[model samples]
Target: MHASREPASRSVVSDVVADCLADIDRIAREYLLEVQKIDDYAGSAVVAQDLEETAVASMELLLRLVGNLPIPDRLAGVSEALGHRRAQQGLPLESLLRAVRMDFRILWTAMLEKVPAEFLPDFTQDAVRVWEAVEFHTIRVHAGYLNELATMAQEKETQRAFLLSRLINSEGKDPQLLGQAARALGVKPESSFIVAVAAGHAQKAFRAGVLRAGVGQFLHERDGALILILEDVPARARREPEGTRAWLAALDCFVAPPARSLAAVPPMLRIALESLPVVTPDRPGQRTVRDAWGYVAATRLGEYGTVLADTVLGPLATISAHERDRLIDTVQAYLRSGSVSETAAELYCHRNTVLNRLARFEQLTSFDPANPQDAATVIAALHVHFLRR
Candidate 1:
């Protein structure tokens, strides 16, 4: 009877050990799996905390089951592994602590099915302290990782702003160099652009993705000051205009309260060159290259200058309106003939009146009324004056 009892006692010990290992393993694996699920879930930080609880509970049960076997160095390995994994993330320590407590509670509950009830509580409390230390270290590592990432993000933003500023300000700079610089900043160039410079009140008009540059009062010189390049759109029907009035209106449209003036690039290159010198007086020697855009700029400037000059002086000419009209008609008619009747009829005056108007016109414009060459000069002057206004 004594021999039989010894063998039965050994079997019981073997069965309990095997059951404790299987239970601990099943709990650890379930907790680990749950932690992974939480990592992918919405509000994963909270889930991560729950997972820590489950792990702590599993560890607690493992300790209780192996209590009589003595504490092994392998328990420390569990803490080390937890530290390494937690070091890779930025989760808060409080969440980990809560998860550790939850894991231990679960382990105690499961172990109670086989473990003597009285022993369960003491086992759990003992293992809880060890898990608490591991959780504390995990939180520290996560916070450090997060701080490093934030610093890196701020540095990148500062660098991007600096490079973009350089790209916008470097005029006549190499295209290849600009493209490379933009690439570094991840800015893509929009092809076929017009560079604009807005000044005054327009300076505050904020638009996302729109670059800003300086500009002056005159449309031509505006570009030389501050310039921002952007894509261009073809004029629509409502936006299109014809004749001098249309041209003047367009100019005014660009000259808003914020902007003293605005000029289209390439099409207004000549004006830009003249204005650029004045606009960028600090750099006086940078205007040698001229191509299609320059020609357009020159033409635009010439048109604008002609309009301005006419606006200031056109109404103040020496010849009166009535006299100038009569003069032109008489001159053209006289050049067409020496016939007095034809000249008088064309002027809507009597023959003698036509002669008198002719004399007065010649005196005023310094042209010989009867001479063909002098008559031609009067005609040319009259045409130019009419067009000027």
Candidate 2:
């Protein structure tokens, strides 16, 4: 009796599927009209076509699944195709899923209307099977959409990296090519921009911080360092002081002065590179071209500055190294503080001890910290001395 009833159920299911297929076209049209009213698909012919095709394909899959036919290959192909098309159109996955659910609703409602009352009980169970097929189809679609989006993101990154490399290296000499590269990098060729170079380990965090602060756009990486091109850096600096400092502290960052044009980038980068070695190790965070200018000048002067430093601090050099270091430290503290008491406080020493060191320095160098002219000379000599070291 069970075996006899199996054929009867199969025959009834087949009839229901055939009826559904016969009305598939009408059902698809109604689905399309309803979906067109949705904002995501409104007035979009390509999206309309995609929706119509998806509805037709879904109905066909439902027919085959209900008829108990093996159509996994067809189901997979249609699902992936729908996902790939939607991803290419830059439509959100949620939108695609919403459309898929709508299709299921239309198809299921049509099937219920066409199925005979005698088979409604059986068809209700078959509806579960239909839902399972929809689940499988949706899984494949999601996978395809994610895969396509990944590929697209990778391609865009590759193009962006290439353009950034060309821009940094000044490979595109012509204005037209430079403009194209700048546009690809999402920067204006004529805009004033600053470039910051950061160490490899800190690059990712530094870039994230800059982006998070919304100060400017980070273009790309070059030579194990991250290169950031910032627009209106001075304004951003003023607006986001705390955020700017946070990222700057995370990086061994060197910033160039504003470049007037894309053509000026290479030279500006060179200047920033030249300024790197002159950055004092004690100053680890962001160093601008202006901040490092004194050291840069000392470095450029090289032997001349070294000789001047030696001659100016010659008396101190004659003393024991320890004593010389102490006296020099005292002078630096005094110069920085501009007062013996403040210098003593900073060095964690007695005021008399600081005063004594200052007296000794004045006696050895014949330059008084109290005298502006002599103090200027001592400061210049100290800068050169540090730069030389």
Candidate 3:
């Protein structure tokens, strides 16, 4: 069976594989047996007959490729179906690759078995064509597998987002919709949750940050704001809403403190968004109602806030910037400490200096920072000025 040393022609290699076609059944059975050892394939639902058929077809495809014969049109669909089916079965891609690559080993072994030894190395040079065939099937298989995976993920996300919309928009009014969404989204009804909101412009950054931080679940844009619902599972301490807010603050988000039940999200979302106007660099990290109460009240007061700001604090705008800041700083410190001596201590100035600044503030605003009745108006006015800025 010895032959010339000149490299084997394409037709010679094709003949060797074509000869093995009679034994393709045995080669396919061996292919199936080998794949069963792979854990993912062993657990998958792909039937033995189907895999054997794919093995046989793949070998035939290699035969045609090496022979330079036209591949049957249907051969393309066979590989595509193989990849898609394995993907649908949830078999890990490595299993399919391992199984697909076997075509080369089994078919090459068959070809070598039938070729003359003197020409074996020359014939072995054609192994690259066998690999080309393997790669052909591999690329189509990869495409089909990846396409199916993308399709599945997109469909699941679309459905999840839709269900979540119903849950939040209906404000959990529909018990059935709430239950369905909760189940799909892995939210528990009895658990406490935090709903954080950011302006629509911050949606993309906020969402990416939330994902990277792993601090929450379920981000969606609703009613001109982007919101995320974080489940407060006690077992996972990091999921605490307050802790989440501390990190989420870096994302320019306002997070409502944890409240019982997902049903209460709509009202909490309102509270979350209400603080956005007050979230300046000086007043950043304000989340709940208590965090920014004055601003919240000012926002609720509507035009009255404007009127209060103009009547009570507008005169300060005309004063020298340094004097105005000194007076405002003394007044705010006095309000926080409730003692002239403590305000002076907090401001690192003598009692007379504090008194003089307070006097100047009274002359400008006509409200005593120490008087409870006047202090309330002054506080409201400051909130208006802060928010209006």
Candidate 4:
């Protein structure tokens, strides 16, 4: 902003202000004392020098602008550097802006103290012009502050992604590396965690939703899948279960059962990825790898498992689909309960009905789901068959 269109009087006022530069150190000191009342900027020794420098820089810049003298590039450079440094420290931008806006009032006070009584009229004419200059300097300060914040945000995300990679790809043998990653991510090493995997196409939406859920801690997309790590669910999320539930249900992904420590996470991550193929459509909220463990193991067993399925379950294909489903469900329930009566109760049928189905299953497959010795093989066959279906 021009000091004045009326050059002579403006130059006289400008010259008067220029003569006041010798008192600048005192003025800057006063400015420091004044802002400290609102905020104890000196509390951070790292920024203590910055407080003094900011005060001095503002005064010098204003003095030059009033004199119509060339403002040094360093003045603007100092402003930008202040923004970058404060943001790098993760300090709020509000304090800097509040301090910056004080420059106008302080500049007026300095001029009032130094300018001779005769020059009062001339200096007074510049009230609007000086305010305009303060507004302009403030504009530069805001620009610098916002640019630095954006840069800091990007740097933090890059660091976060690097830490997540170390956690996911690191071998389980390195508990120390996991600890380091936990520290970097602000998560405790002992915290329970679950790993999840979804289609890569859902990556963008998943990222947006995870922020609201506030559960998932680490996220990244690899190959054709999006990997997400979940930690504590906030109380707010627990109260509004449906929001979080629906959010999770929409994620057609495999979520591994919760592991009690960071050391156990690598296995869970592998399990989540391994179970993805068996993930049925929208398994709804909080689905885990427990139910799909058999299928996941079967997938790894390759041809050996296919043969097991053919030998044990191939007979069932001869029967109607309805009968095959009923028998299979009964056998699974009987194996789970280990009691015919309990299985019948669970299936909401008579105890004799549970016995008949178990007998029928063993008759066809030559393995009894109720016999502990044969149950493992029976389950593996059923898993492989289910996988094939």
CA lDDT scores, all candidates in order: 0.44, 0.73, 0.75, 0.73
Cα misplacement distance, residue 216 of candidate 3 (Å)? 7.5
* Candidate closest to the true structure, highest lDDT: 3
Model 4 lDDT tens row, 1-389: 56236767766666667865767888899888877875536454446577787778878877776666787778857666766766666556787778778888888887777667887776687777668777777777778889988887688777777776777787656877887777766677766665677644455666776767875556665556777766544223433212124576666666777666676677888777777765554443345666678877888888999999899888998899999999999998887779988999999999999889989988998898867779999888878887777
Best first by lDDT, ranked = 3, 4, 2, 1
**Ranking of models by TM-score:** 4, 3, 2, 1
Q: Residue-wise lDDT of candidate 1 within 1-389, one digit each (tens)? A: 01122454344434444565666656676666644544333354435464555365436434543333444565434543443344334454455444444454544444456645555544444344334433443454345445555665567655654554454445424566456544543433422333333332233341111322222211221322433333332233233222111222212112111111112233333243333322122332222223123323434445564554344334336767676665666766876677889877776779998788677765655567588776544444443344444
Model 3, residue pairs in steric clash: none
Per residue, candidate 2 scores C-alpha lDDT tens digits across 1-389 of: 01223676777777877887788889889878777766766644455566777888876876676566667775648877877878888777887777776766776787788778977887676666567666767788888899899989888888877876766676436797678777776766765566677644456666777778786445466666567766543322334222134456556778787676666777777677777754444666687865677777777777888887887898787799999999989998898769988999999999999989888889998888768898878877888988657
**Against the correct fold, how does model 3 do in TM-score?**
0.75
Give the Å error, residue 56, model 2. Answer: 3.2
Q: Which stretches of candidate 2 lie over 4 Å from their true place?
A: 1-6, 18-27, 43-51, 72-75, 171-174, 185-208, 211-220, 233-252, 258-285, 294-317, 334-389
* TM-score top scorer: 4
The stretch of ten residues in a row with the least summed lDDT in candidate 1 is 252-261
Q: Model 3: per-residue lDDT, tens digit, 271-335?
A: 77777654545654435566678978987889988999899988998899898877888888898
Rate residue 131 of model 3 by lDDT.
79
RMSD of 2: 5.4
